[model samples]
Target chain A: MELLGIMLAVLGAALAAGFAGSGSAIGVGIAGEAGAGVMTEDPGKFGLVLLLQALPGTQGIYGLLTAFFAILKVGIIGGEPVSVNVWQGLGVMFACLPIAIAGYYSGIAQGKTSAACIQLISKRPEETGKAVILPAMVETYAVLALLMSIILLNSISF
Target chain B: MTLETGYGYAVSRLRAMELRILGKSLFQRLLESDDFKDAIKTLGETHYAKWLSDDKGTQNFEYAISMELQEAYDEVDRFTPDKELSQLCRLPYDIHNVKVLIKGQILKQKGSKKRTDLLTKLGNVPIDDLILAVESEDYRLLPFGLHRVVPESLMLWEQTHDILSVETLLDSHLFLTMRQLVQKVGYKGVEAWVHAKIDSENVRNILRLRRTGMDAGRAIEFLHDGGWISKEKVLSLLSEPVEGWNRILGFADVSRVFEGVPETGNVDDLVSDIEKALDNYITDVLRPYRYSTFAPENILTYLWSKEIESKNVRIILVGIANGVDKESLRRLLRNVQ
Candidate 1:
């Protein structure tokens, strides 16, 4: 029963990495499908389309960073686990929720935007700058959530 | 809600293909061409060169443009995962073939030579297969319930031999299937377009009945099943004069289509103008969907654009061949945009 706190923390970390990574996978996949279609017609746009397809992949990185921080706080990476109280453990778990939830949803939203941008480039390759900017707009919320999770994780004391 | 944004790959591919569709400038160039051969030469420079490069000569421009339209249909069918949307677009061609085949068989039986050249190859069903099915009177191999429509259409034509009746039945079958597919697709844009189309057909029917001195009962009885304006509303418009139709229909913006309609303008020349106007109205109904990201309606819009492009090219080529004036030819082009 005393190990429940760490268990919850681990579950929180898993959720942060798992759902966010899943979101990125879906987002990147959608963008890739669109990219392939564009490239099928004009293979010259491969470099630009590849960049658009990579836009949705950032959420997975943010989620992994958040998970790594949580693991570091628990000292799990050092093979010496911290003696965290139930409250601190709950605090850590809750802190991870921001990135977990935000990354999961924002990543998919960014992917749709990226796909739209890919289509834009297909039509007007000169507008690649605008295409990149549109999907980047969806990244702001994910960055905020990552920052929030980090600040909250720092405040929790063992 | 999930169905709203699923067509990412198909829509993107279609956007790329749309770049190949002849735009306004190319249409202008074709119009400026000195003659039919010059128009064909100009087309040879575009992606349409695939067929023209073979040196089929200028006389086969109809065959070349028709092939382009067929490619658009086949490509949409191949790219889209949504079978119903593709079927909705392809069904008209199938029904057209069925109508021709049924009439051909009937005419051949009565010692008249059937015009095989009129059979369209753009339908989902192969022309030969559809021909065999219709000739044998066994439709088990047909799709989209064409089996039912085939025998029924043939029976109507055989009993009455009224070409109009056979064609109307085939069209109703086409529109009714379109209505059902629209419901199944559950996309609001498609529903809006189909309703507008049905409404336009209904409005034209009642107006034509009143114009041709035919009984209003025929239109009311044969009115299409699905439309935004009610059948009762269309019935009410039957008694109203041509000028009052715009107000009674509740869509005042469409008053322009009826502008030149005289109280008794029954000439076939003017009929095409009103038909073009109403068709433009329907195309305008779907114009908003062109901006959609991943909806199937976007692909449908591209298909319409392609069809319009093909029609305009055909108009220009045929007009140039016959020495028609530019302004007069321009009047015949569909204002789909």
Candidate 2:
């Protein structure tokens, strides 16, 4: 039973890193395709397009941070393993759900937003600052999800 | 949502390409060019520079523009996710090739080369394949939906032996085919654009038939379907005088074109003016898509704008070669920018 508790906590960390990283990969890929297309016509706009293509990557970093905090709370990295009750283990897993689900979806949404912004910049190069701001707006949800997961993980008395 | 993403890359590239298109200021410069050589020099600075340099003289200007148009079509075809959607823009060119080939065949037996050089090399259908299909009467070589029109047009020609009848049959088929393609693509904007084009063509046909003294019943035969204007409206307009056109069209720009012109003046010039007015109206209708980001309408608008630019260039160069005054040539050009 105690083994099951430790396994569940590890699973929570894995889900956070795995799901969010996958989402970022997809989001970055979508934006990269659009950026490459624009670059094909005018290579001079590379700096602007590259910046737009990187906007969806923040979610992955947030997810990784959450996973690291969860692993550290459980003492799974280097210290002696902390024996957690099933309730505490389940609590940690539940805490990860916010970032896992939100990061996965928001990454895709931000990717689509960034791709559109790249298209806008392609047409009006002078509007690159405005284009960057549009996709960054989608980052707000991912940040909120990260905050929820961090607060929940810290409050749990594992 | 998934479908819009499918076109993301293509639309992005098109947005970049749109920047290179000639603008109003460029047209102004071209209009003010001193003479034929000066006009060619003006074109030399635009995207036409490479094509113009290769030709050396303005004699091959039409051929160069045609090549550029083909390249543009090819670029769109290469990028679009749906091949049929891209082919939608090429339908007019395919229909045009069909007309030329059929006419050439009919005129061949009479030993005339009237339309030999009129065939454009810029369609989804290859010129050689279209020629062969016309010769063999096997339309499988043509695009998917266009096969039946060729045989039916030939049959209509056989029955009436009237060139105008054959042309009317082919034109009606072309518009119907365009409507079907737009429906298949499922874009409301493109459908509206197609309907507007049909309405404009219908109005022009009505005016031409009325001016030529053709009976209203006969004029109805050439009227195309799928326009916003009903056939009944066109039928009523056919019986009315040319001065009443402005009242029926209801578009201020179009009405303004017909307001001051005398009814008894030169019919050719009047007809040309009306055609220019319709072209300007269509250009105005397409202008909104200039800012469109992801819709296929942007691609359609760009293609139409490129064709208008090509036509305007041809008009200026041909006018200069013929020593037609700039003011008279300016009257015929559409406000593309």
Candidate 3:
């Protein structure tokens, strides 16, 4: 039963990395397509396009950090496994949910915004200052999710 | 991608290209230029400068303008996948080329000089392929909408012994193909455009028939089917005079177009006004999609605006060259701004 708990906790870590990383990939791909199109017309706008393209990628890093924290708290690395029972392992798994689900959806939504910003800067490069802010609005949710996941994972006593 | 196609890449590229489009001020500048040479001089400073290399004063300005339009079509084709709305818009150009090729061949057989200069490479079908297809009497070599049209127009000319018959066949076929394409794109704006355009053309044809004293029964032969107005509804207008057209068509709110039709001596001028009203209606229908992301409507509207821009430039340059007053020329311009 205890082994099952440990496995479930690790499964939560896997979901955090897998689902959010996949969402980031899709978002980045969408932005990249729009970026390549802009660069085709004005190659000088590459810096602006690249910056927008990278905005969706941060969610993947956030997901990876959540996974790392979960495994570390359970002592899946560096030391012997913590003596977490079935309920403690279950609690740890639920703690990872904030980033796991939010990062996935937010990543995709930010990508679409970033692609639109890339288009915005392509037409009027002078507006890059504001264009950067449009996609960053979507990042607010992702930042909140990361913060919540980290706190929950650390606070849950085993 | 067929139904939910994303034009993100194409729209981004198009937005940059839109920045280069000549604005109304530039058109007005060309309109007020002192002479043909002066207008050409002002045009030389714009994005059209590359196309102006062959500018032998005013002689080849038309060629430069046509080439610029052709390049716009080429860019849209390159950026969008599938046989998109850009290619559909070129259907008229392709039909125009076919009409010339077939007519040129027939005239050549009759001992007339072959006028190759009349042909434009602005259509989807390659000029060389069109020429080879017409010369070999093989319709299969042409594209979907055009393949069957080549031989059908020839047979039409042979049967009626009237070049008008061939023209009518080609025009109706062009609309038919355009309808098919607009349906395939499954866009509401384009569908509205095709309906309004065909209905507008039908209205014009009915007016011309009434003027010519042609029988009303024969007018049906010239009308196309994809319009929003049913054939019976449009045909019902023949019994009523021109002034009564608004009363009959008012049910569909189509009377709005006919409201501008002058009652007196300039029916021809009123025809242009009706067309202008319909164009404005279409422009309004498409304007909302202008800033939409990843939509084919965005591309379609952009292409239409580019076509409108080219038309205005042509009218201004031609008017300046012909010494028409600026006010009269301004009246002729289609309002999309």
| lDDT comparing candidate 3 with the true structure | 0.80
* TM-score for each candidate, following the candidate numbering: 0.92, 0.88, 0.91
Best-to-worst ranking by DockQ = 3, 1, 2
Candidate 2, position B328, lDDT: 77
What stretches of model 2 exceed 4 Å from their correct place?
Answer: A1-11, B1-3, B136-140, B240-274, B280-292, B323-332, B335-337
TM-score of chain B of 2: 0.90
Residue clash pairs of candidate 3 = none
Model 1 off-target regions past 4 Å?
A: A79-81, B1-5, B206-211, B235-239, B251-270
lDDT of 1 by residue, B159-256 (tens): 98787778888888888989989888888888887887787787778767767776667767657778887788788877776667767764643555
DockQ class, candidate 2: medium
TM-score per candidate for chain A alone: 0.96, 0.97, 0.96
Quick one: ranking by TM-score, best first?
1, 3, 2
- On lDDT, who's better, 1 or 2? 1
For each candidate, the alpha-carbon lDDT, in order, equals 0.81, 0.80, 0.80
The superposed Cα distance between candidate 1 and the true structure at residue B328, in angstroms, equals: 1.6
